[model samples]
Target: MTARVLLVTSEAVPLVKTGGLADVITALAQALRQQGVDATVMMPGYPAAIENACNLKQAGNLPELPGGPGTILHGVMPGSDVPVVLLKTERFDQRTANPYVDENGAEFDDNALCFGSLAHAAVSICAGETDLPVPHVVHANDWHAGLVPALLRMKGITGVGTLLTIHNLAFQGNFAMSAAADLAIPDSMLTPDQFEFWGKMSFLKAGILYADRISTVSRSYANEILTPRFGHGFDGLLGARREALVAIPNGVDTGAWDPASDRLTVRHFSLNDMRGKSGCKRDLQQLFGLPVDPFAPVLAIGSRITHQKMADVAIDALPGVLERFPRAQLIVLGRGDHAYEQAFLGMAERFPGRVAIHIGYDERRAHALHAGADMLLHGTRFEPFGLTPLYSMRYGTIPIASRVGGMIDSIVDAGLQGTIPDDASGILFDGEQAQDMVAAISRAFELYARPNEWHLMQRNAMSADFSWSGPAEQYIGVYREIAPVEAQALFDERSAAVNDSVNLPADEEAAEAAAMPEYMTA
Candidate 1:
């Protein structure tokens, strides 16, 4: 029997996005379609999502949903033929700033109920209560859709495999135990071993305990979340269910990101012919009111200015980078954490034309920033997968990033131990200190001065295959594992496929370091 999967997410590209998760979901669904898996994305009907989706129509309704009532609208995702199902209700329609956050940058007060409605809606599709495909697998992404597996179990639904993909373990959808009854989660399932996390009910924890299998964005991150330093607080629980864990690395949305064809970039460029790059660089400089100098190194930083992204550390080290590389120019895009925003604003004022900062996220600027920059500064305390770095690499822009999580897998650090110079794609530093960041930035400038080596590195980065084809196939394997296929054709046909998704628990030393946290919601 052919495999059918329902991909439950909070966002997607061209419709809405807060980060890389949207791009990953869109790419995965498109790739899965190419490989014969009947993948359908289910997300909330934010105003943009509804407007961007093609051929939209009412699919069904969930009247007594967690948040009162919700209508499931079926349509094709923006810019793709992959089927999309969106939850339409007042809970999602009223708030427009961020899907999960309000205008004040605070997470939606009723997020538990909001996403709870999303999870319940997925169950409606799976249980054949709606006029949609009865999926063989329900693949829930991040903490937002974390309750899918638990809701399936609670409703006594069988023959449906559940897979939870942890995009970022830190943002676990944790809320008060008092709210458990509202979502219909039972007290028996709210114990420490189940969904209870530090006297709270964690949506992520519920999925980890009940899902047929669990997956993270990358192999390195899969292992990282198994420890205390990176686990946030769920490492011990994840370790206990270690046998169910797997790693599927995220892939780039090559169609939207390629510099040669991207509609957002000022000038198109390719690996063989990089002549247009200077024009794009000039446009970038002029866009920020800086001198249009072709010789100056333009370093781009595009990410949310949050503690997890080392925004605090960047505030301290960026001034030193400006002083050390007087001719270098910096362009930053993304918004988060007010203090860091103010700090960058102050730095821009002090440096005048040399430093420029864009306070919020914009698709056009994001594409231009990568296409024009010589190098990208991406220092994350922990990364599920380095989508920004990978996107920059596709544009022939090298990255100076932290040596953690997915960055370890994606970036080939120059002059670092266990790395070959000819294959080095970017610069990587291990420490979190400002000095370490400056050291990495310093090394990038040194590499930039050598034209031949820098060009070679850029070519290597541009040529690297970060597509979704490989990872999507691995996801198919995951679906086939617990899915009740009527025929043996799936196994017989895919016998040649590599079976490398397994990730056994790390040793005791690694397990001791496992932990999780709730940064939002009390």
Candidate 2:
């Protein structure tokens, strides 16, 4: 019996992506399949998700989810051949732009009801109500799919173990306690230790309390959440489950983020070759309407413009940095709060040729920003995993990032005073002010003057292995830890046959993939 996993999330890549969650789901599913886990991705059938599905076909019908009835659509991810299960219901089919939010960025009115339907749909599939076979475990992501573990226990469905991956703890699905009845949330489960949080029902708390095992995106974040600083008022509940919590870092999609083969990069460049990056820089400068100066260093911001990301600080600090480094150009790409958007727009107007701002998200432009820039300014108050910094590093763009979450785990600072120049990937700073970011970028510029040292740091950044092979097996261990004894036997047999990676840590589990090596499909 093959150990099957149903990976559930609100978004996925190449179809819909609001943040790093989508890419993680797509890549992790592909990597899991390679290690012989029969991984199937489950998500709401948004119009794009349904349309982009490869070999789409009707799988089964969902009876009565919270909102209404739905059908299960089966297919494979377009690029990665991992199986996809979509719940196509009236609520899920209605929204077109930004799955969670509307055109103006306001959340949908019936978000609780709609996501309640998603949870019910997952349980329906697992209870053998649909044509698809029951998975051994249901792997839920973030607060969007947080209700699954609690719902399973409520309905007395005991066959499947549950694992919840907290991508961002801040976005807990907290709603009025009155809405619980419409969501079919049982009154019994509403307690301080369970779904209840300060008289309101929280979807994230439900998963934290009920899931057999829980995992955060990074190891530091796992420990960080157990404290009051990063707990978001759920520290006590999370502390109780600390023993079950694990930290599994996210993997980069090399096929999509790699500089050498990325279609959106316009020009290809790699570690061995140095000529193409200059051409890419010129192309970016031309596209963004900046002066075509190859000698000028381009500092880029490729992230959401919000308080958590400290976009306000960047807006205030950039002027001083730009004035100091006279030749350094700044490129801003991403959209969020209207105030921040307007602020960035104002910035472009103030510094005409020196500062260029594109107040929206475009995949191609994001790639170009990384390919062109000398350094990326990624400052966030808290980050589960800083994938953007990793993406920039892939293009030999050093990131001057805040020392939080995965940034601390991934970036090896280019020494305090050129101490470990050889091993340094990027610069990391531990401060939370506008001046702090300035000081960090100052260090980056100082290193930038030393061309040989800067090139060595870029080489270290590009040579990093953020691929999925290692992390996939660690997820298997978490699954096996929670699995039933009988299921564990089956899982172990399959694991041995795949790569002999049954009891290995994530870093030590990178053996040859035996079962399904062809991850991406046309």
Candidate 3:
């Protein structure tokens, strides 16, 4: 009696990844399976996915989509028990290094059609037109799978609930209205209320309009999207569906991210032991070619270099910070925005040995940064639910983050609160200005000078739980709310069994926390 869910997404970790969406989809699917929900992920068969998948077999063949016929392949996600259905078609098979963008950094010309084919396949499977098992709910993630809900409704399909989760509202899949026929979108459903957004066909608007329930990665983001600032031009439509919207914050995989067992880092350390961290710190300095000063705080930035991430602010503040603390070293890893890249490279030139910048992302180095750095610098103007700060905290690294989105939800600002309590996890600045960042870095330096206070905050961060167990349970509650009566009974039975098996200390608290972050509650 398991409530089967078809998780429609563009990417999954270990198979394909360009951003946090891949990690979120894979982890959520795996966690849902652990809780007795039959969650299966459905994604386009990019060459990387097909190359890396395990136990791959032909599930079935799909009817001709706008692109062409596709062969559905079933496989288990590498290193996890979660089942994955890959839609293999020439449209997806020929994708460049990045799924959405090509070598020239331009989006693929047929991206709308390529992702539309993915949505069509998902809707077909949910309607029991494929060899795959019919899902009780079709949960679509982001714009790539956004067309599923609208297509289902347009085709008059029923009995399956649709849930659309907006990971980031900034990247709406908007295409030329003339390409509607190429995407196989019906003319009847092209009105402003459905898929049309300012004379363009929008895949994201379709999902938001037709899905039974809408959710965002964090509670603050869900509330933020109701206004013009965060809504990305869909505030009015989102406001109309306010009652249907829910905010379920994403969670980290404790087993995969555990500092003790992580194979990516040079040295593994836990909360109890303090010796290994120093070893890691030295190793990180050597890796980045920075002067090995154990006393000099190492600040790391592991995010995309983009305007949204406020990388410009960090760039502008670095000179003042280095001047204030002569021995401070900064290490940056990520690639985005050519302007930011040039700016960071210029900063590295200005302060050789003190600043190390890597233009592209390296997973091992990111893990090392989290494990070895004394502090993580996350200065974002807007973030949906950042996984970097969560990873940093788990590695016992204090985060100096902007007070926005998930950063506000997870990090208790020691600087703002004026006390280093047991729960004080990081330093939070109020704005994206360079001066604000300077003040936050200064506060970080102040806390670093007080070893006892700094250690307390690190312990608080390490002790805090940000695992998938909490978020999975909240998702189950959403499933129960939208699922049929029989499915609800099944969910109740599974919830009891899961609770009995997992011995979770904060299951009840997590369930309550899903409604709203504790800080927001009156």
User: Which candidate has the top score in lDDT?
Assistant: 1
Question: What TM-score fits each model?
Answer: 0.95, 0.93, 0.93
Q: Can you write out model 3's per-residue Cα lDDT over 2-102, one digit (the tens) per residue?
A: 78999999999989988889889999998999888899999999999999999999978886786888888999998889999999999898984889987
Clashing residue pairs in candidate 3 are: none
Q: Which stretches of candidate 3 lie over 4 Å from their true place?
A: 416-418, 493-522
lDDT of 1 by residue, 399-497 (tens): 999888888889988964333488889998877789989888888888888888899899999999999888887888778776765522452246225
**Tell me, what's the RMSD of every candidate?**
3.7, 7.1, 5.0
Q: How far in Å is the alpha carbon of 336 misplaced in model 2?
A: 0.6
Which is the better candidate, 1 or 3, if ranked by lDDT? 1
Q: Per-residue CA lDDT of candidate 2, range 174-241, in tens? A: 88888788888878778776688988899998888889988888875665666577788977887777
Candidate 2 residue runs with Cα over 4 Å from true position: 415-420, 492-522
Task: State which candidate has the highest TM-score.
Answer: 1
Query: Of 1 and 2, which scores higher on TM-score?
Result: 1
So what's the TM-score on candidate 2? Answer: 0.93
Report the alpha-carbon TM-score of model 1 versus the true structure: 0.95
- In model 1, the runs with Cα more than 4 Å from the true position are 416-420, 487-492, 495-499, 502-522
Q: What's the lDDT for residue 147 in model 2?
A: 95
Q: Report every candidate's CA lDDT.
A: 0.86, 0.85, 0.85
